[model samples]
Target: DLAAAPGVGVDRPRSPQPLVTAAPRADLVIWAPPDVAAALRPRAEDFGRTRGVSVTVESVSDVRSALQDVTAPESGPDVFLGPHTWLGEMEQQRVISRVTLSRNQQRRLAPKALAGARYDGQLWGVPYAIANLALVRNTDLAPQAPQTYEQLIANGRRLKAEGKVNRILLQSTGSTGDVYSGYPYLRAYGGGIFAKTPNGQYSPGRLVLDSPASLEGARRLAELGREGVIQPDVDNTNAVPLFGDRHGAYLVTGAWSVPVIQASGVPYAISPLPALPRGGKPVPLLDVDLFYVSATAQSPKLAQEFVRDCATRRDVQVRLARATGLPPALTAAYRDVAARDHHYAAWFDAGRDGDPVPSVPAMQAVWGPLGQAFADIVAGKDPQHSLTAAARQISSDLP
Candidate 1:
C-alpha cells in the first residue's frame, strides 16, 4: 500500500522547458474518446485563432492503451482526456506530466474536481466532469421513484405481476460480479471496501471490506439475489435492451445511459440512488474525468494554457456537457445547465453526494476478490462467509 501522503499541493514538474511561442501554424494535438472528440473539433478553429496555434482534435479508442504507446517526447498528443483513476499507473509509467494550477485557476471550478485531479501531492490534470450511478425511473410506467431499494424491488414485483413489465430494476452485472455496480449498496449498508485518510482521500493500506457495515451490505446483496430481485444473467449488454424495450421500470445506471434512454422514447426522471431500508444513504463511487497534459509535449507551456482553457472556460465546458449528456465539472455550469435540465442536475447532485474511490496501486488488488465476493453474494452464497474470505484475501494482497 502507498504511504499516506500530504494533501494535494506538492511534487512540481521537473522538466527543463525552453521558452517557445506557439507558431502561427503550429499544431496543438489532443486525443479523446469519440464523443469528446466530436465536442472539441468544433471549437478547434476558435481556440486556434485565440492562441495562435492550429488545433487538431483526434478521436482514439481505448485511450488508456494508446496513452501507453506515446512515451516518446516528440510524437504524442500534447493533451489526453480520460478517467482520473488512471493517475497511479500512468504516473508510474511516466506517461503523463504534472500540472500546477494557480489559486485563481482552482477557484474557477469546484473543489471536488481539484481533489480528484490530485495524485501523490501534485495535480496531473484538470477535472471537468464527475460521474456517479443513480436511479432513472420511467415515470410513465412507474409514476413515482422509490426512495428505498425495497420499495424499488416491490414496485418491480408488482409491475411483473400486472403483466406490464418483465423486471423491476436492471443493474448491469455478470456471473463474475460488478464491484462498480454494487458499490452504492455496499456503502449504504455501512461497509466500504476502503477507508479514507484524514485528508479525506482514499487510504489504500486500510482495508475495511469485512467491517460490520460491509457484512450487512453483503447480507442485503444475498437477500436480493435469494429473493429473485437481481438476476445473475443481466450484464451491461442486456441491461440496456431490457430497459430500452420498457420491460424494466427503473435502471440503476450512470449519466452515460441518458442518451440511449432518451432515444428509446421512454419518459424518464433521474433520482438520487435509493438508500437501504436499514438507514443507509446510497453513496455510489464517484468517477471524475480529467484533461491531462502529456509528458511528451513539444510545447509544455502551450499545453498548460490549453489545459487551463479546457478547465475554466464556461462555453467549452457547457458545450461538452451538452454533447456528453453528463454534468459539467464547473459548479457554475452545474447551476447554469441544471436550471434548464433537471436530469443533468440530479446527476450532478448525486456526484456531489458520492465518495471517491482511491487512485492508488493497492486498489488494484481489491477489485478481483471484491467483485467475486459480490458475485457470490448475489449467487446465493453465504454473505458472511464469502465476505470474510474475500476480506482476508484483500488484506493479504495489500502491498
Candidate 2:
C-alpha cells in the first residue's frame, strides 16, 4: 500500500526548486482530454503572448497512461490537465512537482478548490473547475422537488404504481457497482469510506467501511435492492437515456449529464438531494479538474507561469467551465458563470455541501472492494457479511 510504503503519504514538503527566469526557449506542451483540449486550443496562444513562448494543446485519450509517461525523460507533455485524484499517486511516483501559489493567487481560489489541489500537506496543482452530483428531477413528471428522501421514494413509488414512470430513481450502480454514484445513498445511512480527522481531512490511518454505521448503510442498500429501487442492471450507459425518456423520475448525476438532458428536451430541475428521514445527509463527492506541472519539464518555471497566471485568470476559467459544463474553481470566475447559468450555480452549491473525494494513494485500495461490497448487497448477499469482508480485504490490501 502506498500509504504505508515509505515516502507516499508522508507530510514531507520538498522545496519547489523554482527555476530562474530565463528567455523562453522550447515550446511548452500541455496534454488534456479531447474536450478540454478543444476549449484550450483557441486560448493557447494567449497564454504565451507575453512570455515569448508558444503553447501547444494536445488531445490525449487516456490521462492515466499519459501521466505514467511523465516519468520517462522527454516522452510526455510538460503539463498534464487532469483530475485532482491523481495528486497522491503522481506525487508518490515523483512524476509531478508542487505548485507554488502566491498568497494573493491562493486567496482568489475557493477554499475547497485550493484544498483539493493539495495532497500530503502541499499544493501540487492549479485547479480550474469543480464537479459534483445533484438530484436531477424531470419537472414535468415530479412537478415539485421532494422535500425529503421519504417523499422522493414515496412519490416515485406512487408514480410507478400509476404507470407514470417505470423506475423509482435513475442512479447508476451497474453490474460492478459504482461507489461514486451510489455514495449519496450510502451517506444517507451514515456510511462513509474513510474517517475524517477533527480538521476535516481524510485520515488514511482510519478505514470506516465496516463500522456499525456503515453496516447499517449496507443494510439500507440491500433494502433498496430488495424493493427494486436501485438495480444492478442500470448503469451510466443507460441511466441518462432512461431518465431522459421519462422512464425514471429522478437522476442522481453530475453536470456531464446536462448536455444529454438538454438534447432530450426534458424540463428538468437540479437541486441537492433531499434530507434523509433517519439522520444522515446525502452529500455527494466533489471532483476537481486541475493542471499539474511535470517534474521533468524542460521549462518548469514557464509551465508554472502559464498555470498560475494565464489559466487561473477569471476569463480563462469561466470559458473552461462553460465548455466543460462544470463550475469554475476561481471564486470570481464561479460568480461570473453562476450569474449566467443557474444550472452551474446548482452544481456549485452541491459541491460546497459535499466532501472532496479522498486523494490519498490509500484511496486506491477502497474503490474495488467497497464497490464489490455494494454490488453484493444489491445482489441479495447479507449486508453485514459483505461489508465486513470488504473492510477486511481493504485492510489486508493496505500497507
Candidate 3:
C-alpha cells in the first residue's frame, strides 16, 4: 500500500541522504580487560578531541564472556581490546567487521601482528601488542642461555645428574604437551599444523603437521621422555611451580609467565628459542593483542575512525607497550621501545622467527587430537603411528 503513496516510487526512496548518513557521531564505549584498562582509558579524551565522541571505559571481568553477545548494541562494546585469537570465533558470529586499511596504513604494522587477526584476506582487527613463546632461562642455575636444543638438554642433564634439580627443562603444557608451547620443536623439523602457499597464505585444506617431517619432530619429544629429562606426567601440572621454585633451569614459555618467574626470586634472562642442531630454527607461537570494532556499534563510523586514527597513534601505542611491557605491533612504536629495552627487543626478534597461528575456524581441529598424539609419543607410543592417527582424526573432523 505504501508503494502507491503520493510522490513515492517502487524502485526509489524519497531521499537517499539519510541512508548515506545513517551512522552519526555518537559516544563510544570501549570494553577492555582489567590489566589494560589503564592503558586504554587515557585515550578517551584523545578520541573525543579527534572524533568529537566521548568515550566510556568499561572494565571487562572476563574478556571472552563479555564479548559473547556482541550483536547486542546496548550491551556490547563500540570497540573491544582483547587477544587476536578471538577474531575467528567473533567473525563467525558476525559480531565484528573487518576494519579496512589503506596501503600506507598496512605498512605501519608488523606483518605477523596483522596476520594474527587477518582471515580470508581481510584484516579484521587492529593489532596493538604481540606476545610469543620464547626461552626463559634461570640465570642463577644456568649461567648461559642455551644456543641450541642440544645445549638446553645438556645443561638440564648435568643439573639433574648433579642432584641440583629434579627436572632438566620445564615447560607448562597440557597432558599431551601444549601444541602452542611445543610448536617451536615441531617447527624445528619443518612441520606445522597448516601449510602455506608461496605468498604465505594458509591453505587449511593442506595440513602439514602430520607429514613425515612432523614424525621426526614427534620423535624428538619422545626422546625427552625416554632420556628421563622429563617424565611423561611432569609437563602440565608442575612446570610453573617447579620453574618458580628453582627446580627448572630452563623454561620454554611466553611473557605471560614472566611475573611468576620474577616473583620466585630467580635471576633470569629472556632469549629466543634455541636453533636446532641440524641447521633448523625453533619457531614459537606469536599471539597479538588487538582492538576490534563491534558490528552492532551505534556510531560505527566514529568507532572505526577512532581505531584507525587515535588508537594506533604512536603515542598511544607506545604508552600501551610501556604499561604492559608487551611488544607493540606498530612498527614505529616497537622501534622506539626496542631501542630503550633489551627484554622487549629479544621478544620482538623471537616473534619474527615464527609464523602466525592460522586464524581459520578449522584450526580448532589441530588442538585436541594433535595434543593427545604428542602426549602418546612421550608416553612410549610410536611417534610415527601416533602422529599418523592424529592427522587422520584432524582430517575427519574437517568438512
Candidate 4:
C-alpha cells in the first residue's frame, strides 16, 4: 500500500489495498538562498522518508541556472522550489505545470500567497513560505513605534541629533531589499508600480511612478536621507551590521531576518511599516517561495503527486515551520511551534495585512530604473527628477 492516501478520494477500507505497490521516489531540487537550503533540507528529507519515498536534494545558487538545468534534456528534476514571482515567466515559457487546489486547500493559504501563485488564470505553484517587509526597530532607542512615515522621519532626525543612532538604515542598493523598502513609500502616497485591471491582468505600460504622489513620496525619502537621518551606505550587507549593532534605530527588513536578529542578541521589535499621509496604509512588499513540477519531468504524475503531498501534509508543513523561521504557507500550520514562538509571532501579525509583490513579467523592468533612482536620490539628486526619470524609463521598458 502507498504510505499516504490519494488526495482526490474519500477514505476507504485498507483490506483490499493493492497487493503490489510501486516504490515512491522523487527528486526535490531547490534554487534558493544558501541559508534557506541549509535550514529546509532536513525537514524535506524527513517528510519524504515518512511517505516511503526516496528523496534526493540538490541546491542551485541561482534560479536561472536551475531553469536551464531543468529544461536540459535528461537533466530535469521532478520538482523545483523557488520564488513565486518566477511563476509568470515560467508559465509564459511553458516550463512549469499548473497545480489545481480544492476549495479547502485554497482557503488554507493566506490570500496574498494564493494570489501570487496564479498566472494567466491558472495556479502554477504551491507556496512554501510567505515573506513581507516590516519596520524592525531597536527597542532601546525607540521607546514607541512610529505610526506614520512623517513621524518616522521626525523621530529619526531626533535620534540622529541625539547620537542615539547612526541613521534610519534604508537600502538604496541595486538589490531586492532596495525595491522592497522603496516601493512602500510610493504606495503610501497612492502610487503603484503596475495597475491591475478588473479582470486581473496587470497593465505595466501604465507605469505611474512619475505621478505627483510618487514624486512627493520620493522627495520625502530623499529629504530623510539628505538630513543624515538615513545611513550613507545603502548596501544591504552594510545595513545589517549597523542594525545588529543598534547603530540604526529602524531598518526595513523581512521575515528572513528573524533568525539573524535573534542570533545577534539585540533587543528589537517588529511593527507594521508606518502609514502615509492622509490615512493610507503603508504597503509592504510580499515575496513568496513556491513548489513546482517541471513540465519536462519523465514521471509527471509521480512528480505532481509529490507536490500534492508536500502541499497538503500537515506534518510536512509543521516541519518546514520549525526548520525555517518562516511561516508555513498552510493556515493550519500557522499555530505550529515556530509560528507561536516569540521570535516569529510578531512577524505573523505584521504579515496579516501585507501586499503581494506584482508577479507580472513586466515587473522586471522596474528593477533597474528603480535602483538607479534610489541611488541617485541617496547621492543628493532631486528626488522628483530622479523618480520622474525612473518612471519614464520603466514605461519605456514595459513589454
Off-target runs (Cα >4 Å) in candidate 3 are 1-26, 69-71, 235-237
- Model 1 regions lying over 4 Å from their true place: 1-26
lDDT (tens digit, per residue) of candidate 3 on 1-399: 001211111111111111111134338877776667677778766778675557776666555555653445666678878766566766887878889777787899988888887877788889999888777888878888788878988888888888888888776544655666656767787988888888787898997877877766777877876876646565544676688888878877666666677788888888888777666677877778888898898778877987888777888888888877789999999989888988888888777867776666676677778767766777778888887888899899874
User: What would the TM-score be for candidate 3 when compared with the true structure?
Assistant: 0.89
Ranking by lDDT: 2, 1, 3, 4
Tens-digit lDDT track of model 4 for 1-399: 111111101111112221121134244443334444555567567756886756655554554454664435346566777777676667777778988778888888877788778887788888867777778888887878888868887877788789887676554343222666677777777777776679755666677787887776777667766776554465656655668877778877776666667778888888887776666666767777788887776667756776676655666666666666667777777667544675456666667766676767777777768866776776678988888888888777777
1-399: candidate 2 lDDT, tens digit per residue: 222222111111122222221234338878777767778867777777767778777777665554554445566667878778777877888878888889999999988888899886789999998878888999988889887878889999999999999999888777777777656766666668889878777888788888787777677778888889888888767888898899989998888788889999999999887776577577778878899998888778888888888778888888899888888999999999889889888888776777778888887777777777888888889988887898889888874
Looking at candidate 4, what is the lDDT of residue 176? 26
Clashing residue pairs in candidate 1 are 1-399, 156-168, 191-213, 191-214
Model 3, residue 373: C-alpha shift (Å)? 1.5
What TM-score, to 2 decimals, does candidate 1 have? 0.90
Local distance difference test, each candidate: 0.75, 0.78, 0.73, 0.66
The true-versus-predicted C-alpha distance at residue 90 of model 3, in Å, is 2.4
* lDDT digits (tens) for residues 1-399 of candidate 1: 222222111111112322222334257877777777778777755777887778777677556656555546565678888877778867886778998778887887777777878887788898878777888888978788788888898888988999988876787657767777777778886679778778777777787788888887778778888887887887666776678899899887778877678889988888888778768887877767899998878777878888876556787788788877778888788777888888788887766767766777666677778777888888899988888898889888876
Which candidate number would show the highest lDDT if scored against the true structure? 2
For model 2, state the Cα shift of residue 91 in Å: 0.6
